[model samples]
Target: MSILPLLIIVPFTFIILALFIHHVRIKNALSLILGLTNFALAFYILKIVHNAGMLKTQMGSWPAPYGITLVADRFSAFMIFISAIVFLAVTLYSIQSIDKERLKNNYFLFTYGILMGVNGSFIAGDIFNLYVWFEVMLMSSFILISFGGEKAQLEGSIKYLILNLISSFFFVAGIGILYGKMGSLNLADLALKFSRIGDFPSLFEPSLILLLVGFAIKGALFPFFFWLPASYHTPPPAVSALFAGLLTKVGIYSLIRIYTLFLHHYDYFWNPIILWMGILSMVIGVITATSQFDFRKILSFHIISQVGYVIIGLAFYTISGLAAAIFFLGHNMLSKTNAFLVAGWVHRERNTLSLKDLGDMFNKHTLWGILFFISAFSLAGLPPLSGFAGKYLIIKAGIESNQIIVAMVALFVGLFTLFSMTKIWIEVFWKNTKNEKNDSEQRIKSNGLPYRYMITASIILALSIIVMGVWAKPIAEFCETAATDLLNNQKYINFVLG
Candidate 1:
């Protein structure tokens, strides 16, 4: 009856129903219906939270310490709402993009499974449940990434699987250690026990480190990010776009959750490490992106770099800093999704993502060129766009925190991001090539625009980026409120388990 259970149940039910449907259209329709219903429920919950502050639902009549608890605070509800919007957009885009024979019903099942996992993660109150949700999400992602069984897809999926499994092992080990020390898997219970124990500092430090490392691997932070670029470029563009937009952010969401809740006292130990890694990730990702010729490869690398900005904000540990991080998280999701969608369109048109092979596309498809330009400029943090607003807030936070060096690094990284975007722009949009000679010579070429559905979905995301930038005040306020809830663990635990 509660919205929390529906978040997981609807998707799970649809996935099971998909197994019995023989008609592709019926399956697709069913999936879309489920996605829309889930999206609606997420908004309904958001409205309830907005009016009533927070919402919690315990499974059955059992209390928190004995039964599963689902909690939707301002922060979790906000993530679920955004994630629902993204699922709707991606599902709509996939209607025309995916091949029936290659992906079929299994695609929808995996997609829905992922949605369930993401929703579960957003609401889960137990550490063990969080781990379960993470594995569910990861398994679905593995299947989705390797859907068509292409050589590239298989290779990427394999690498991703192995790395993630290793990360999962570490995660489980950390959870086991925490349970051994505290005798409870419930997050709030552990926090209480941790605060009361006299020798908590010594025992807590290693467990926290292991937990942070596990999350860092998932988030694709520096030294653990090689799998991201290697695997992300192999999937179909829509899948790539969805993964780029949502997956890493889940890791980020977990990091924010862990640090602010159980490990608040460990801030001094981890913040500097996060700060340095953020800087290194930004510099390295941009540099690697500039060196790549494949459009998707470049975009994949940029995902790593942009995540750096989010980490930097959290590292500052100020209200403005966390708020800026949240703003950037939303902004980056929109911009990156649009970028990958545009890249997919370009690849569809030219049948190649190589910059050397595709050129002067702007001359033929002006609309796509313009759209790509807007998205790219926004991604580069141009003024009056969503990206700029986030960057400004993060930089301002850095200044306020007296982290002058990190602020300078962030500014420099923004310039490099611009340079990488320009590189892609000149190569794909403006460069003249002999290969285009015959195509250009034709007097009348039919538009043959890449899938209209995809374009429409991408345009919606681009518009959101612009709108979020133009009217940032309310969103900023929301981020601040969410950050306050996140940092104040007592509020979160009481809301979930009371």
Candidate 2:
């Protein structure tokens, strides 16, 4: 009867139904209804959290150590809410964007499957369950990435699949080791048990390292990020938007959860590695972004770079730092999804995503041009946008933690991100094309704003970015509470297992 289990069950139920239903209209209608309902439930969960602080439901009538548990703390609630909103928007946009003949019913099934994985990951109360959810999400994502079965998509998906599978192995191995040592996969039980154990430093450290590395691979951090750019741009824009918005954030959420709840004792060992990785990823990601001629590729690289800022904040391991990271995670998800939506619109109009082949869009598509600019500026951390608010908070926290180098890296990375954005703006919007012959003017003329709904959705998200920036205080307070809950751990355990 608990809603927590429904978050996973409902989407999967629809996925099964969609697989058998061949009618496209029914498929789209059902998918949209399900996505919206799920989003509403996520919002309702947020309301419950606001009133009660945390919500938990045991899978059966059994107690903590004996039964599976689902939890909705402030952090989990925020992530679930964001994932639901993005899933709904993407589902609505997919109605016009997806190719009926190529993907058909399979697209909806995979999409819903991905939602199930994402939502389950947020609420899972045990490490083994978390791994199961992560695999479900990743496998669904692989299918989504190669949905249309294009050559490029197939190639990219292979690379992505290989890397993620490797990461999954590491994750499974780490869980096995942990279970062997602790005899419990429940996060609360593990935390309590680890606290009681005194001289088992070596065993705990290796297990923590293995688990974190697996999360890092999933997160697309530094060395494990090559797969992201290889495959992210190959998918359809709607699929790409969902992947960009939610997938990496899942990895980040897992890393944050494990670090705060189960691996706090190993901060000295992990923090330094995370700090350097953040700096290296920021520099490398921006540089690669600058070199990219394709719009989606640039945005993909920027995703890596922006993630570095979040990692840097969390690596500092202070209350303010963790709070800043959470705020940035929310901001980045909204802004990144908007950016991909813009890319999709541009592709729909021009039939191409290459910056070199696109030109003079700003003068013709003024509304979309403005929306793109807003999203890009937000991603670059420009003032009066949510991105800036997040960057400011993280930088402030870094400085307060006496990590001056990290603060400076964040600032420089922001400027470089701006440079990358400007490059896209000038190439695609400002510059005049010598050959407009290849441009799909006839389609644009006939359709007359083909991606209108998608554009509207993007604008709403962009507005949220601005609003969150202007009213930072309330969001900051929420993030602070979430961070404290993560650090304290008892609230999550009590709510889930009590």
Candidate 3:
């Protein structure tokens, strides 16, 4: 009766169907249908979790630490629901945004593959399975990143592959060491075991550190984040949007899940490390982003900066802090992806993402200009948008937790973010360009492409950002419940083990 499996099943089914369907129209139609179906299913699953608190299913008649388990508490259910929304929006955009050759090459196939991996990771009940899902994501993403086989795509995919593979090695190695020490892979069972250890487990901390390094790299945290900016812009805008929305977030989710289950025991050792990494990631990411002119690259670096906000929130380790982290994560997913979606439109119109080459976009496409404004300012933490609410919650939590320095840093990062976003707005949308190559003919040629799909997709996500902002109170309260559930680790352990 558990709907958890359906999240994985629906995407896997789409992948299979995509294999047989050679027609591009059929594939796009199927992808949209499957995306809608999955979104509805995710919404229902979240509703059930809200009513029932938690849901779990054991596979193949096995039980507890011996089985393939899927579990969803409020946090995971909420992630699944948000991911479904982003995935659906991207699918709609890709219908018009992706080129025909890439469509022929099974772009949607790999995209659905990512959806499967993301859904699986959210519900994975064991560390080993979590790693497996990560690999699933990496493989599909590797192919997508290089699908066009452009020189830049090839180069970017190489860096992405090498760095993520290293992440995999560290993660699987940590899993091995943990299993050797603890004798179980199931998360709840592992939590039960870790909680029973009386003294601070020095031996276990190394394994946890190894795991953290892996996650930090995967999540594009400070010093481990070079791969994201180097590569995220090389892909088509739709692909970049997908990666921005869901992939790094899985790594962040893993960090939160593991910290709740195991790492929190040694707060003394981990808190400062997490806290400072967040501080550096915030300052460094925003500063670097300000130097970028490429549209997607700027947004890519902001991904790092925004993730740091979530990290600092987690470091605070209070119910408010975790809730803010969760809220921010969801808000960033929508806003960041929508920014990239608008960038796709920019590319389609101008054939380049260089801000210097893009100007007077507001004059040509007024609605897209508005769309970019909504998403960009929201990301800058401006008022009456989801990003503002998210950042407000995080800073308030930081102050309430007496982390004044970190709160101030977060506030200033928002200012830098606003500056960079304004730069993009001014250079790309407001200022008129002097480039003669982009004449009226060129604009008409690019504008001739079917735009309803792209416009509809951008509107969907833009509306989501507005709704989350206007209705911030109820959403933040739900996030608080989810955070409380996360902090209360015993609830998770008991549900899975029982």
What is the C-alpha local distance difference test score of each model? 0.84, 0.86, 0.94
Local error of candidate 3 at 21, Å? 0.9
* lDDT at residue 51 of model 3 (Cα atoms): 88
> Comparing 2 and 3 by TM-score, which wins?
3
Q: Mind giving the per-residue lDDT tens digits that candidate 2 earns over 191-224?
A: 7787788546584466777888898888989988
Better by TM-score, candidate 3 or 1 = 3
- The reply for model 2, stretches above 4 Å from the true place, is 436-449
TM-scores of all candidate predictions against the true structure: 0.95, 0.96, 0.99
> Candidate order by TM-score, highest to lowest?
3, 2, 1
Give the CA lDDT, 0 to 100, for residue 162 in model 1.
Answer: 93
- Candidate No. with top lDDT: 3
**TM-score of predicted model 1?**
0.95
Instruction: Pick the winner on lDDT between candidates 1 and 3.
Output: 3
Per-residue alpha-carbon lDDT of candidate 3 for residues 1-498, written as tens digits (9 for 90 to 100): 667888888899889999999999999999999889999999999999998999999977699899989999999999999999999999999999998989888889999999999999999999999999999999999999999889999999999999999999999999999899899999999999989995663744768888999999999999799899999999899999999999999999999999988899888778889999888999999999999998998999999999999999999999999999999999999999999999998998889999888898898789999999999999999989999999999999999999998999999999999999999999999998786565687777965675999999999999999999999999999999999999999999999999
Note the residue pairs that clash in candidate 2: none
Worst ten in a row by lDDT for model 2: 437-446
